[model samples]
Target: MDYSALRRRMVESQLRTNKITDDAVLDAMGEVPRELFVPRALKSIAYLDEDLQIAPGRYLMEPMVLGRLLHLAEVKASDQAMVIGCGNGYSAAVLARIANSVVAVESDAALAQKAQELLVDLGASNVNLARAPLTAGYPAKAPYDVILFDGAVQQIPDSIVGQLAVGGRLVAVLQADGPGRAILATRTEAGLSQRVVFDCSVPSLPGFAKAPSFVF
Candidate 1:
């Protein structure tokens, strides 16, 4: 499969057409070889503009949604960023291109190892891949300027919010009743406030499922 051509089409048709106009995001998505981020068996469908199931219950986010979230996060070249559920580390690689340093957290040990190898092979020196439970955001590198959750979550944990610096941004797909909402929550002097940026569905991150409440 010609991944280059497919990637070009993805940027042109999916990203650009869908209003992901950030040049940094467009260039990074174009430059990163998506095929390198997926297992060999699924590399042929790497740039298909849809989520590709990676493991039994996990998936990579679609390109357009990922691009839009990255753009909304407003990653700066000098900012430190944290990426939750790094899934093969593709999103982290893309963030590394824009952020000064990136700490990518992965829950699965095998996927973490794979991501480390792939990032090394891709020469993404700015990204550091670590194995951790997906719900527990990396706190060793606390006070990150931006936190990006690579997939959807039923709710954002306060623990994760505590790791961000005041005024830092957290971007993720927040699952609501009707549909998944792409939200950008910013840490403020008073408290964190979130606004829905767009609507899209992405696979949910493990351990973020809302707990059931007791009956009245």
Candidate 2:
């Protein structure tokens, strides 16, 4: 199979048509062999126009959704980025090309190992893999210029938000009980401000959903 051709088709058909205009994102997606990130059984369908579940409850976000989120974040070449719940590290691989440095945090040990292997195999030298809880975020490398959640979350916890630099941006899919909406959050003098970017549903990463309420 010609992964190069499939990648081009994904960029042109899935990403470009959906308003993913960032040249760096386009180039990185086109170059990174997405098939390598999924289970071998699913490699042939890696470029499908939807999310692929690599684990029981984790997913590799759809190409278009990922591209749109990255575009909305406006990741800069000099930015220090962080990816929360970076399962398999596909997003981190793509981001390693655009950001000067990336710290990818994952809670699952299996997923973390897979991510580390893939990132190193792909020569994503700038990505620092952190094995930790998804909801907790990696505060060891706090003050990142950009933060991205690789999956949907019910809310952006302050624990994660505080890690962003004084003037940083965060992107993620926000969903509670229905469809998810991609959102971009920015930290300012007062507090973090967020705006919905688009509507899209991707699988929720482990530990990001809202805790169950006690019913009397």
Candidate 3:
């Protein structure tokens, strides 16, 4: 299997055609052997156009979706980033290429360990894997320049939002109401400013589900 050729095809077909125009992002995505991040059985399908399941309720975000969200976040070479739900660490690997460093938090112990191993093997030295609750952003390393939730969520917590440095950007897919809306929120002196970047549908991260409302 010619993974390099397949990766190029993925960049041209799934990404460029879908508006993933950031050259740095495109190059990073193309260079990362996505197959190495997934289970052995799924290697052949790693570059496919859809999200691939990494766990029971978690998925590796589709290439275009992840690409566009990262594009919207506008990561800089000197920026610090935090990735929630760092399944298999693929997102963190891409982010490490853009940001100076990345702290990836994952609640699932197995997933966290797996992500850590894969990231090290891939030589993503700037990523720090944290096995902690996804809702609680890694505060010890707070004030990050960018924060990304790798999966859809019902609502992003204020605690998580507060960790952003003033002028920092956060990206996530909110799936509370209708179809999911990919959003970008920037921290400001006054407050956080938010805008919908696009509409997307991806599996929701566990523990981010909306609390049930009572009905008569």
Candidate 4:
């Protein structure tokens, strides 16, 4: 299969047509071999305009949504980044091209192992795969310049937000209510400042459900 040609088509059709504009983002997405991240049976459809399931409850995020969120995050070359729920490590590979270094955290043992292998094979030297609970952001390397969620979440836990360096940006699909919305949250001097960047549809990362509310 002509994966390279298919990737180009994806960039022009799925991405550019959908309003993904950042050059760094465009280049990384265009360069990454997405087909390598999915099961071989699904490789032909890996670049389809939807999230490909890697596990029962987790998915490799849809390309357009991922692209848009990263574009909103404005990842810089010198920044340290973290990818939460980094299924198959595709997001980390793309971030590795842009960010100086990336620490990708995954909770599922099988997925984490597969991601680590693929990353190593790709020579993603700056990307480190760590197996840990997704909700508890890797604090050992806290104060990251950028943090990205590879899936949707009902809310950003204070603990995870605390990992971002002041002035750092974290982006994710926040589906707290109604339809999902892409959010760009910046760790600020005062506190975390977040705003809706756009609307999106992304499967939830395991363990990010909002806390239950009490009623009278």
User: What CA RMSD would you report for each candidate?
Assistant: 1.1, 1.0, 0.9, 1.0
lDDT (Cα, tens digit) per residue for candidate 3, span 16-126: 998778888998999998998877899999999888998888799999899999989898999999999998899999998888999999999889989999998999999
User: Each model's TM-score, in the order given?
Assistant: 0.96, 0.97, 0.98, 0.97
CA lDDT for candidate 2: 0.92
- Candidate 3: segments with Cα more than 4 A from true spot: none
Per-residue lDDT of candidate 2, residues 85-178 (tens digit): 9998999999999999999999889999999999999999999999988888888888999999999989888899999997899999999977
The digit string of per-residue lDDT tens for model 4 on 1-216 reads 999998999999999998899999999999999999988889999889899988788888989998998888899999999999998799999999999999999999999999999999989999988899999989998889999999989988889988999999999888877999998988878988889878888788889898799989
By how many angstroms RMSD does model 1 differ from the true structure? 1.1
Q: Estimate every model's Cα lDDT from 0 to 1.
A: 0.90, 0.92, 0.92, 0.91
Cα distance off (Å), candidate 2, residue 38: 0.9
lDDT of 1 by residue, 2-36 (tens): 77888889999999998888898999999899888
Model 1 stretches astray by more than 4 angstroms: none
* Span of 10 residues, lowest total lDDT, candidate 4: 197-206
Order by TM-score, highest first = 3, 4, 2, 1
Compute the lDDT of residue 38 as modeled in candidate 4: 87
